[model samples]
Target chain A: MKSVVVNNISKRYGSKKAVTTALRGISFEVDKGELFGIIGPDGAGKTSLFRILTTLLLAEEGTATVDGLDVVKAYKAIRQRVGYMPGRFSLYQDLTVKENLDFFATIFNTSVEENYDLIKDIYSQIEPFKDRKAGKLSGGMKQKLALSCALIHRPSVLFLDEPTTGVDAVSRKEFWEMLRKLKEQQITILVSTPYMDEASLCDKVALIQSGKILSIDTPEGVVRSFGKKIIAVKSSNMLNLLADLKKTELLEDAYPFGEYHHAVLKNESNEHELKNYLQQKGYPFEIKGTDPNIEDCFMALMKN
Target chain B: MRTLKFLLQKEFRQIFRDPSILRIIFIMPVIQLIVLPWAADYEIKNIKLAVIDHDRSDYSRSLTNKITASGYFILTDYTSSFEQTLGEIEHDKADIILEIPASFEKDLVKESESKLFMAVNAINGVKAGLGSSYLRSIIQDYNREVRTEWIQFPRFSPETSIEVTNSNWFNPSMNYKVFMVPGILVLLLTMVGSNLTAINIVKEKEIGTIEQINVTPVKKFHFILGKLIPFWVLGLLVFTIGFGIAWIVYGIYPAGSFLTIYLFAAVYLLAVLGLGLLISTYANNQQQAMLISFFLMMIFVLMGGLYTSIDSMPGWAQAITKANPVSYFIEVIRMVVLKGSGLADIKYQLLTILGFAVLLNGWAVVNYHKRS
Candidate 1:
């Protein structure tokens, strides 16, 4: 069964004449026990979409439901069952870790002793400094405490908006591992991130950009739908190669990536011809076929 | 109810943990209550009197002696020339001039009446009005003394004298401290109740914690009550401390029952805290909340009749005080503390504040949206 279903949701901000649209007819779903990711860059309306689902905001058009209840009509009921951690670290800074945890637990009509099993792994890591104020904790510890607070009630669905936006690599990796453990307990998860690589970690992802969804599929399925040949080209002089590749008629797109430029060709067979044109320009280079990652797919989708 | 309990626990913990808030909540009121009443005194004293006694007769000198002995004047300049005394007033040395006409003792005995021209420098209007009144009462006393002395023996003409005896009731001593302490205590309670709660929710908004609270299962009514109850309790705590200071430092014990004072305070805090929450709902950040609260507080305290009498105010200003919650509290506190007014005596004020409590809190609740 679907845990979350959003259909044709739209939202606008500001006054009448200077209105800025934050979301535009966006639609998607998250299955029960599925880890769903909404991947996009900043200002891509990820936070706005999470706020709509969490009932902190109202959508201008369309409808959303959480756990078989309408988000607009049954917001209070949804609030009980859905856990949301905003993009910002919003736990009471003056409160100790233990106090923050207990506060959330008691407010949800439970105690730390009751739901100790659900958050044991995450809470135990910060339990050593449970008496320390949350503001004094490291970024990774703060994120962990926030997640623990959001899950104190053992919510059926959790919405994390950019949980790893500022976390280090090791912590981000560990956070994903904890989410995997949570998924095992049959909890639906909807996470949004600006990091494209994190998209592959989700069971399914909807790539969004500028208030519009570019694509929605499994990570591998998204890569398979690229339907075009991409080549990685590098030379001693890498800067001029990108500009020169875009000038060529045989290339469909060219952009710099790390030390090499990933070039999309109009025809897969024209690779040899494109190489000859570069060689004629007195440039010695190396070219080979490369698998398009989620970012490359995102670029392809955004361009269209 | 459980959710509200947790909310209060969190709020009280946060309040106790912040040292600055604790100092503001406890120490500020103590200092203000001990210091403000003495400085905000309304009784005018030590008027500078310039006596231009043109008659320098035995009766005139005796009258000047009586005026100087009244303890309200300093007798700054005693010159015969009126122009010289006017110069004394110009230099701010004299606040009033008593010019006794040069009739000698013959005019009063022969005509049975005397005219005295007095000039008062009305620059500081209150001081001038008070100084002249004090002088007039002393002269009246001297006249009654002369009339009674002459009546001790039979005279050629018969005269009737009507004597008016005045007495001040309630505050018999006319003690400035007694009159001012209760009013100041009311103002302190208002400041603490409104200013603290005003910045409370807006602080959460600025720190981004309100979004977390908004997404919780807590209802809006519970959320607002959770915010209000702790501060409401603390506001009353401040009032208790202030009342203690008034008793200990100023020796002001309320003439009415303590129960009546607390009963009014309990309802009054709801109105003030409700106004604060209303401001918090409209303000997006702590800075905006502080600014709006400060602005409204200045208007409320100034027009609340603490420093000035509401009866003497202009018609429009008095109209504004009708809607001002602070004014009603100030009046009620004075009535209970100084005049020993009972609850039945202030039933109108109680119902009016109750109405304000409902209107303001109802408005704040309607504006405080859990989802937007």
Candidate 2:
């Protein structure tokens, strides 16, 4: 069943003369218990769309429903069904970690002891410093506490907006693992992040840019339809390699990818022939065929 | 109900954990309750006196001695001429000058009536009026003494027979401190409660915790009420400490039931906490919230009759004070503490504060948004 369905939602700030289109004709859906992801760079309207879904902001046009309740008309009901962890850590800093969790549970008309099982996994990591003020917790501990608080009431659908942006690599890995476990509890989750590596972890991914979705599909499906053979070639002079490849007639698209150059050539170009041509040009380099990952697919999609 | 309990618990924990905030909350009220009463007195003392004794008679000397012995006045200088006394008044060195005409003693014995010119500086009309009244009463008593010794009159004079008995109600001594301590306590509660709550919410907005709450199954009303409940209880707790100090140190216990004072204080706290929430809803950060709340609180406390009696103000000014919640709380507290008034005496104030609490919280909950 479709747990969340957003259709043609648009949001604009200020009047027409100076309006900022934060969300533009965006539409998507999440199935029951599916871990969906919105992958995009900063300022790509991820936060705005999350706000609309959480019922904190109303879309200017179209509609969104969370767990069969309308986003605007059924905001009160939606608030009770959805758990939202915004991009920033907004828990009461003055309150202790334990107090923060207790406060959130009470707001949902529940208790920490009642929902202890749900938050135990994440909350236990930060439990040692539960008495410490939320303001004093490390970035990773704060993320854990925030996630634990959001899950206290056991909402059906959880919306996490860039939950691991500032966290360390180990904590980020730990947080994603926690999400996978949460998926087992049969809770639908919609998470947004800027990290391409993290995108592969989600059941489905939506590549967004400039308030528009470039593509949405499973990580492998998006990579399978990358539609071009990619080549990585490096030379002793890397800058010269990029400038030289862009000037080549066979190369359709070429840009620097990490330490090597990822070059997408015309379909008709032969790999052996291209290597010979570069060899003749005295380009001391190693060339190899490369499989497309989500980052590669996103870059390809963004080009169009 | 559970939400309120949880919120109150969270508020108490927050207040207890922050030592600086706790100190400000508890110590501030006790210091203010003790110090403000002494500072906010209307009783004028140490008045500078300049005397120009033209007669320089033994009677005039005796009258000057009496004036000096009054203790209320400080005999700054003895002026030989009227011009010298006028110079002293012009220079602000003297508040009042007693001018005795020549042959003043002879006039008292022969003419039986002599006009004594008393020049009082009336720039501060209230103080000048009081000083003049004191001087007149002293002269009248001296004249009565002289008349009694010279004449073979009856023991009871007509003025003495028709005596006017005065009674000071509530605070019989008219102790300015007694009235001020309660008002200052109100001021402290409003400042600490409102500003602290305002900063708390705004800090969440700044740091992104509010977004986490928005995504939860927590209702907006629950979230808001949860947040305000803690601050409300803290305000009341602070008010209780203030009341305790008033009773212990100042011997100013409430005339009514202590429970009534606390119950009413709880309602008043809601109005104040709602105001803080309202401000936090509009503010994007802690600094902005603190600034706006500070400004609003200054206006509320100043106009709340903490320093002056609202009833004594002009009709229009008094009308303006009616809208201020602080004014009603101060009035109600004073009535309960000094007069021991019951519910009927403070019913109007109670209802008005309840109305303010509802309106402010309604506005806060409505304006409070989860989205940026």
Q: Distance from true position, residue B117, model 2, in Å? A: 8.4
True contacts kept of each: 0.91, 0.80
Tell me the deviation in Å of residue A37 in model 2.
2.4
The docking quality of candidate 1, as DockQ, is 0.70
- Tens digits of per-residue lDDT, candidate 1, A230-278, equal 8899999888888899898898889988788999888645678878888
Residue pairs with colliding backbones in model 1 are: none
lDDT by residue (tens digit), candidate 2, A190-272: 99999988999999999999899989899999988887788889889998888888888887788888899998877898677
* lDDT for each residue of candidate 2 in B182-264, tens digit (9 for 90 to 100): 88888888887789888877876787766766655555776787787677767888888888898898888888888788888
The TM-scores, chain A only, for the candidates as listed are 0.96, 0.95
lDDT of every model, 2 decimals: 0.91, 0.86
Local accuracy of candidate 1 as per-residue lDDT tens digits, B16-84: 999988999899889898888877767667899988888889988988898888888898988899999
- Using TM-score as the measure, the top candidate is 1
**Deviation from native of the Cα of residue B41 in model 2, angstroms:** 0.8
CAPRI quality level assigned to candidate 1 from its DockQ score: medium
TM-score of candidate 2 versus the correct structure, residues matched by position: 0.80
